[model samples]
Target: MMNLQKKKLYTLLALVALFVILFICNMLLSPYHMRIINLVGINIALVVSLNLTNGFCGVFSLGHAGFMAVGAYVAAILSLPLVKKAIILPELPKWLGSVELSFLPSLIIGGLVAAICALIIGYPVLRLRGHYLAVATLGFLVVIQVVITQLQDFTRGARGINGLTQYTNTWWVWIFTCITIYVVWRIINSAYGRGMMAIREDDLAAEAMGVNLTKYRLLAFCVGAFFAGIGGALWAHLITVVTPLSFSYDRTFSLVVMSVIGGMSSITGGVVGASLMTLVPELLRNLEVGITVGGISIPPLYGISQIVLSVVLIIVIIVRPKGIVGSREFSWNLFKKKKWNTMNQMEN
Candidate 1:
């Protein structure tokens, strides 16, 4: 119990320190670079949220993008200027057209909308196990895509919705990222989180031990959807546009890749993986090879960074299936304790 308390305190302190550093960086960095960092932060939120269902609860949900779309559209609509929305979405309900909100409130409302949708969807889909669940969720994604496509008045259909104010910044992104990481870390260390882990480890055993399988699973699913929705809102605001295709299978695959490469069980791993993967392609795109080495000029493949990253991910999975950080979390004690003990010894 003492050790657990100590570990918890250490974790809290570490989180605080990390947030402070990220906040400072956000303030100091240029908008362009900050945008990249913000992308990493948002991806961390998305990946970690997905891990609740995929890693802790042992559910395979390929339809997180659906929740994202719901959030994006909801938040976008709420944040848009009344006059501009009137011009773009002329047929919108008067109530919706009259309402406007700041970024944070819109994000929360978006999350709530996504959570409600998840609750409704999870009722039937969560009953299926393994591959059936995967397929069912994939179908849900398709259904969402179709709905977005058909919602011509609200979503702008295939033409997509644009002219959104770019309100998201590195500060907002990192603040939310820290909140997400801390919230998830707290949950995973709590009894509810333990129950989810138990279900993941052995569903039958967890059921036998009096864990409400359906309730916990649905809770995890809802929480995951809520955060995914938040991420979507941030993304929509950052790009100043909302498109149905942005939340399609390709986007889902990228989120899945971050979770997998980071090691599903490791929150730190997820954040690190998301950051690395988000930046790598951009870095590759900017690389200029003007000189030839050994008479071989390095041609830029443009799209080859993704392929290289994918191959590297495959090799890592084969070699260290547990991911880069495995289940290890950041520990201030590990670094601070030794120095403290040495100081004591020297004084003695």
Candidate 2:
């Protein structure tokens, strides 16, 4: 227990230090750099939440983008100024139109709404397994995008809500990212998590052993949807717009890539993958315009970043089919094991 407490202390201290550094960087960094940092936090929240269902529960879901859209539109609509609501969404009910809210409540409400939707959807959908479940969830996302497009009074009929208040910042984004990580970690280490993994490994055996497949699956799905909603709220406020185009099938595909590239079964893998996917593309932006090498004028290589990044992803998957981290997590215990191994080697 003492060792556990010490590890907790270390983790807390590390988080404090990282937060302080990020807070300082938030103030000092250039706008572009700040945006990148903020995006990293948003993606962290997203990819980690995704890992809860897709990774821990071993469920195939491709509707994360739809969940995000639900949250983004809900939060964005709520947080918009009363006047903006009146102008942008003239069709809003009088009660909703008249009401205006602060950021925190809006974000939470958005998440809850999304979770409720997920609960309703997952109840029946979770019964399906394999690619059937995948297709079902993906269809759900497609339906959501279509509904958003049709809700002209609420969503401006595909133009989307615009000029949203900027309540998202480095602090809110990263603090939520930390909360997401903690929540998923706790879930993973619980008995319930073990049951989920059992179901993943062998559903027939797990069901025979009295593991509740639908219950655990739904729990993971709802939890993941909740956090995905929060991430959507963060992204909406940061971008100051909520458009149907923003939360399309492509977004889901990219998130899946992040989960797979980092190791879908590992939380740290999600973080690493999110960081890599977010940063590498942005960092390589210069390659799009042109690169002057030793006074040699190189023509612009438009879309080069995508090509190179795709190649890198392919290589990573070819080398590590289980993902970069496989099923392993990054923990301090690993260092102890390494030290003990070295000591034994020396004695031998």
Candidate 3:
């Protein structure tokens, strides 16, 4: 116990150090590098929240983009200045025009709205398993996109909300990133997390053991959605825009890939995976454009990042299907066997 406590303390100190380092980077990095760092932080929040639902609860959801859309639009609308909102969304009710909020409250409202949506959908949606669940969630994403496109007054139709304030900074993003990590860590160390794991291992057995599948699944889904909402809000403010296309199928695919590449079963996996996926492709993005280095006039590589990432994904799938840190924590512990009492408790 003492050793475990020491480990915990050391981990906290290490995270603090990292936070400080990032804070320093925020101060010193060029705008482009700063943008990349901010994006990495946002991806970390998104991928980690995704890990909570798809990783821990054994739910293969693909509609996280829907939650993100809800969050981004909601936060954007709320945080936009009243005059701007009136211009962009001229069809909105007059009362809504009077209700502009600060950035933090907008983000909280966005997260809450997304969580409520998750709870409403998850109750019935979680009943499905495997690919069916994936399909249903994908359907949800499609629905959200359509709705956003149709709700011209609310979402500004296809053009999307634009020219907003840049409320998201390195500090706001990393703060939420830390919150996401802390919340996920607390959940992972809890009984619900154990039950969710049991469900992942074998839902039939978990059900037999009274693991209250619905409750735990919804818990994970809602929590995950909430943070995803927060991430979407951060993205919107950072980009200073929100649109139907902002949270698309492509976004969902990348996030899932991030979770799988990092380690579906580990919290640190989300961080590593998010960092790797975000940074590597961005670092390679310049290669896609033609550059006149030393007057050589090199042609554009065209999809260099995609090709490299595909190769990496192929390697990961072939060599480590569970991911680089599969079934392990930051300590790099070797794979360990599990006992079955994890999900034996369930309230009927």
Q: What is the TM-score of each candidate against the true structure?
A: 0.89, 0.95, 0.91
Better of 2 and 3 by TM-score: 2
Ten contiguous residues with the weakest lDDT in model 2: 339-348
lDDT, model 2, position 14: 88
Q: In candidate 2, what are the lDDT values of residues 1-348, reduced to their tens digit?
A: 127777777789989999999989977899789889999999988998898899878888998989999999999988899988888899998888988999999999989988999999999999999899999999999999999999888899879889998899999999999999989888777777778778888988999999988899999999999999989999999989889999999999999999999988778889998998999999788889988899998789999999999899999999998788777777755566652221111110
How does model 1 fare in lDDT? 0.83
Give candidate 2 regions above 4 Å deviation.
293-297, 339-348
Instruction: Give candidate 3 regions above 4 Å deviation.
Output: 1-5, 290-299, 332-348
Candidate number of the best TM-score: 2
Cα lDDT tens digits for candidate 1, 120-211: 99999998888899899889999999999999988989777899999888777877887888788778878788899899889999999999
Which segments of model 1 are wrong by more than 4 Å?
1-28, 288-298, 336-348
**lDDT of model 1, residue 94:** 84
Show pairs that collide, candidate 2.
Answer: none
What's the ranking of the predictions by TM-score, best on top? 2, 3, 1
- For candidate 3, write residues 149-258 as lDDT tens digits: 99988888999999889999988988899889888877877788889888999999999999998998999999999998989999999999888999999999999999
Find the candidate with the highest lDDT and give its number. 2
